[model samples]
Target chain A: MTETILKVDNVSKAFGALRACDRVSLDLRLGEIHALIGPNGAGKSTLIKQIAGNLRPDSGRIEFLGRDVAALDTVERARMGLGRSFQISAVIAEFTVLQNVVLAVQGARGTSFHFLRGALSDRAVTEAARLQIERAHLGGREAVRASDLAHGERRRLELAMALALRPKAFLLDEPMAGMGADGVAEMTGLLDGLRHEAPILLVEHDMDAVFALADRISVLDYGQIIASGTVDEIRAHPEVRRAYLGEEDAA
Target chain B: MGRETLLNAAIALGLVAVPVWAHLAGEPFIITLTTKAVILALAGVGLNIALGHGGLISFGHAAYFGLGGYAAGILAHHAQTFTPLMSAPFIIEGTKFMPVIWLVAVIVAGLAALVIGALSLRTSGVYFIMITLAFGQMLFFFAISWPAYGGEDGLVIYVRNEFPGLNTLDPIQFFALCYVILGLALWFSHRFGRSPFGLALNAARQNAERVQTVGIRPFRLRLTAFVISGMITGLAGALFADLNRFVSPSMLSWQTSGEIMIFIILGGVGRLYGPVAGAALFIALEHFLGGVSDYWLVFVGALLLLVVLFARGGIIGTLAGREVAHD
Candidate 1:
């Protein structure tokens, strides 16, 4: 077994009467894409928020590199290499693509205290930003303001920012969301290659992409994991069919 | 140079030229009016760092301004009276030196901002604005009730503070000193908006959650900007008190905070020289319109409404075009 880079052990979250996540236990090992799939209200967002440090679990421990990170905030988690991409693209609308990527690079390298020098002028940050921009296929549009970018391009920009973190693991929420067929295909290839750099905890709606990329699949239903297994095992799982995946996939 | 840069240069030249031309025409009062504009512009510039770049609408900035004025006034008062600032412990003495007064004002204001920002930054938007206003009002009433500083009657300085070789008593000399300080402030503001810290702060303003996900805490960034902003405004307050030869509770009033915010809105919220343009226009309107009618501020109010309704970017944004990415 490869080393477990991220461990989510018995995490539970409740909002009033509704439990968002209930005793969720999952882990991402090095160099694997572990896909979390569910219906609209399957508590995927809540789980991702808990993992990303945006929401707190009522009980359970989240360990990154064998150390518990339940006390950390979102900023602290990001600093500790827990890269996250939002479902709705969250790039700085006013900043150019390069600027957005440079922010992530600056954050990762701990250069935010630099008051005198321009972030762009810093060769180290800019170079890293450029590399990530290229990796995310945003090479020619470096100077484009994030707001002006096409929907697919904005998603790519998020990926670029996430990559710039040099993260130990990625908690990507719907990276293929709002993309056309071509965009989905391109992102699928990108996520396919991304597993080598860092393990990915992908929360995606696209079944095609998830099935193609995920070494292991976790099917979430009403804040509980109905099934957790390899792609073939999850496909064949009877409980997963009734709760999620639907009768269509099973047939 | 860019269009805004050219416009800024023109405004700079116009500010200097008007005072000089007024001095040549023997219109000392006009020069004084221009000096007031410069000092107010400096205050606006200070607020812009927090309000504009950091998206922190600090409605209580007048607290720093008033504290700065009181620092200069109290120091000069004690200096002339030959009394130590404190009788016990360290036995610190007061001096009527401009640099020392300015230093003290900046430090005091910065410290105040640190405390205020620590509490206030926890809430955002309207809550943030109200809390800041509350803090400013608290200071205002404190100053009004404090008998040692003459309460609401205010403190008067017999002479302006000294600044090395130049005679600060001369209008032009004093104007020159203010102009130099304003220039330094504008240069700093320009550079600050492009720096790494500025980038992070700006990002935090636009999308704080995005900023956090990028591993930067918006609270620390905003607090730092607030302190720096307060320090700058405080410096302006000292200059303003020196200019008037009086320090009063009115300097700490909510109306003063509104006026500083007006300077930013009138010029351009985040524009480098937005406050400069806004301050100059505001003073000009007050001077020219006050002579015409007692309700001169009505016209200013109307203009502010028009700016808000039509030109959302304010004066510089309307004139120079929409905000462009500096990078």
Candidate 2:
């Protein structure tokens, strides 16, 4: 594996009596798609939230770029090249798609504090934003209000924004949750191309997309990893079958 | 031309034209009435920055307003009596200069906003509103207890403060001073709304989580807007105290805070001239309706109810038509 870009060491989180993430450890290598699959309430979300710096883990540490990031908040982590896509598709609905992406571009460049010069007149920010939007196949929809876009288009817009940061690593939480069949296929193709750009930590439910795009798969059940290996290895793992894919699939 | 542009021009022209016509006809009282509208509109513009653009509903802005009024009253008091305000270090003598008073007013208000915003912005929704209102009331009660400047009875200025190259006591000249200030404020608000900082603040208001994901701190953006908003309102408060030649606790009341909010809500929230339009309508109703009956506010209340129910975008948005979607 290439140099590990993100390392989660024995991370754990609990809410009251229920243990959400129990000593979870995972590492994402450069230019690799690491898929995390689990049943509902498998503590997958808890782990992702901790890594994204949104929730504080009770134990262990999260290290990004070989430095401990346990003290950082979400915005600090984001500024340090940790790009993320929200599961519910968070976006400023009042802003135009171009403005939304431009806001991200400005953030990445650390020039969003400019007050006097009109942002609409800035060619550099506008061009960079346009390029990201175009890459997401949203070329003509730049001026469209974000809320007016279709559900799948909003997902694409979110991806475009996430990519605008030129992030070293991506943490996408169910990016395909609300997409239709064609949109899913299109997104899978898009993500398949994006692996060379950066490593992606994908937490998804679509097995076909996971099997097709993931370089390696890790099965999570009840806040613990049952199995972790290459796609075919995970496909043939007997314990994973009984725990996740079901015994009938193994037969 | 687009409807918004045409209506904007008309509003600007109407505000100026009526005052000019009344001035030439030798009816100076009409000019005083229009000047009242202009000054209140200036206060509304200040509130718009926090409420409309920054999406901070500060129910305690009257604190700055009252403070600004007191700053003017206190300074003029010392200047008129030929007494130095302080002697411990160097003597701090008060001045009758309007510019100096305005500077002090803006700084005092800006500082107050910084403190209140720092605390109140930590909460949101109804909590934010209540915290701000509580702060205003705290100051209000303090002003009532402090009898040095007349306390609840209020302080009065015998002569209006001086402005360079003008007789400020003259109604027309005073109106001109206010008119020029309002125009500059309007222009500033216009340029500010489209700048990067303003856009980021707007995004923060709409979805703070999204802003954080993009690596921007919503709190910083909000605090900056709040300070600027307070300074503007404070300037208006100084002028307002000058307008009545009096500084009173009524200026700091929660009812005054509600009135400022009414100006914004009755105008377009995000529109540049919303406060101007709202202020004009309010002044007109107060003057005309109050002249006609003892209970004119009932009619005004009914009118406000109608606007809130049906015209959600306020007078500016209603007249401008739906925003034309660009290709």
Candidate 3:
């Protein structure tokens, strides 16, 4: 098997009496699109949050590139080439789309504090930002304010921002949550292309997009993985059908 | 090419021309008033870094402003007495100039910012505001209680400090000095807003979690902005001491902090020239209203409430409208 880029070992999280995440274990491999699917409140976001270093799990270990990263902060993990796109659109509303992407490029370049020269005037930073924007199909939208962009374009901008980091792996949460048919197709095509570059762990509810794009599918129920297998195996599994897909597939 | 640059240059030119007109028209008081406006505006610009761009409501900026004023005052007092600042450790005397006083002010304020920011950054929202206010009150009391160079009474300068080859005693010339520094501070604030570090600071304000996920520490970025903001305000304080030839505990009061915040809000929060516009309006209001009635502050307070309620953006913001870029 290809080397595992990420390993979550028996991670559990609790808040008061609720076990938000319970002993969830998973492995993500190199250059593969792995999908984590579940009903609402099934703890998929919580798991993603833990993996992205936003929240610490009560009991678990996360290993990335052979080192345990449970103690690392979010930014430190990002600097180590871990990129995450938020479930909510979190672009700087006042900044131009190009400026937002440039910030990410600057972060990856490790020169966020260079004060004498204007960041806009820096040729290398702008060029890299432009390249990432183009790669994410946001070529013409560069001059628009992030707030002015359409919801789908904003989602694309978030992806462009993540790509700007030149990340080793991507943790994407609902890239297609609010997209229409055209938006979904465009984003699916983009993700399909990115699968050749870095490992991607996507948390999505769009089963059609998930099955079409994911190399491996994991069904999460009540903060626990009920089933994990290839598309065919997940489609054939009775437990997954009883818990999630039975009603939907019947319709 | 950007609208921000055009507006900043326009304000700078207006300020530079004011003293020239004062010099020609034989109105020396105009020059003094202009200098006062410029100095206070520069202080506002400093506060704008934390409040506008960084989204840090530092209600205690008067601490740095007062510290700067005291540095100039204490140094000038010791220089006149022909007393070394320290004899047992080493011999250190005081010199009066725009540069030396500014340096001392910047260093002192920067150090204080480091300590205050470390503590204040621990909390956010209302807690942050209260913590900063608490720190400002602490310094205000300390300045009032210390019986060194005037205490509650105030310190008076026999002569204005000198700048190299500039005569320094002429009111118009002094106005020109303050105008140039204000212009520089405005430019610095504008440039800082567009820098990479500035982008992160703005990002942190918008979304702290997003910034962290991108691999940037929010606290460190904010702390850096806070220190730079304090240093800039401190420089303005040094000039302010020379403006009135006086330094008092009132300079460090919470009222002073509120006034600085008012300058940013009244002009247009986060706008490049917001502080300048706000400073000009505030001084003009003070001059005009104070001449008309002693109850002018009541009107000022009413106007501030109006701005906070109806006009979310200050005067420049209302004039410029919401489409103006502010980060």
Highest lDDT model number: 1
Report lDDT (Cα) of residue B2, candidate 2: 80
Residue range with the least summed lDDT across 10 consecutive positions in model 1 chain A: A241-250
In order, candidate lDDTs are 0.94, 0.89, 0.88
lDDT of 1 by residue, A155-242 (tens): 9999999999999999999999989999999999999999999999999988889999999999999999989999999988989877
Error in Å for residue A24 of model 2? 0.7
Ranking of all candidate structures by their DockQ, best first? 1, 2, 3
User: Which is better, 2 or 3, measured by lDDT?
Assistant: 2
Model 2 misplaced stretches (Cα beyond 4 Å)? A247-251, B322-327
lDDT of 3 by residue, A50-150 (tens): 88887899998999877899888888899998888988888878788898898888888888786657888899899999999999899988888998999
Tens digits of per-residue lDDT, candidate 1, B222-298, equal: 99999999999999999999999999999999999999999999999999999999999999999999999999999
Estimate, for each residue in B158-243, the C-alpha lDDT of model 3 and write its tens digit. Answer: 68888997977899878878887887887788689878888889988997887877778889999999999999999889899999
Interface RMSD of 1: 1.2
In model 2, what lDDT does residue B38 have?
90
Cα error, residue B137 of model 2, in Å, equals 1.1
Candidate 3: C-alpha lDDT: 0.88
Clash pairs for candidate 1: none
* Candidate 3: segments with Cα more than 4 A from true spot: B1-10, B322-327
How large is the i-RMS for each model, in angstroms? 1.2, 1.8, 2.7
lDDT for model 2 comes to 0.89
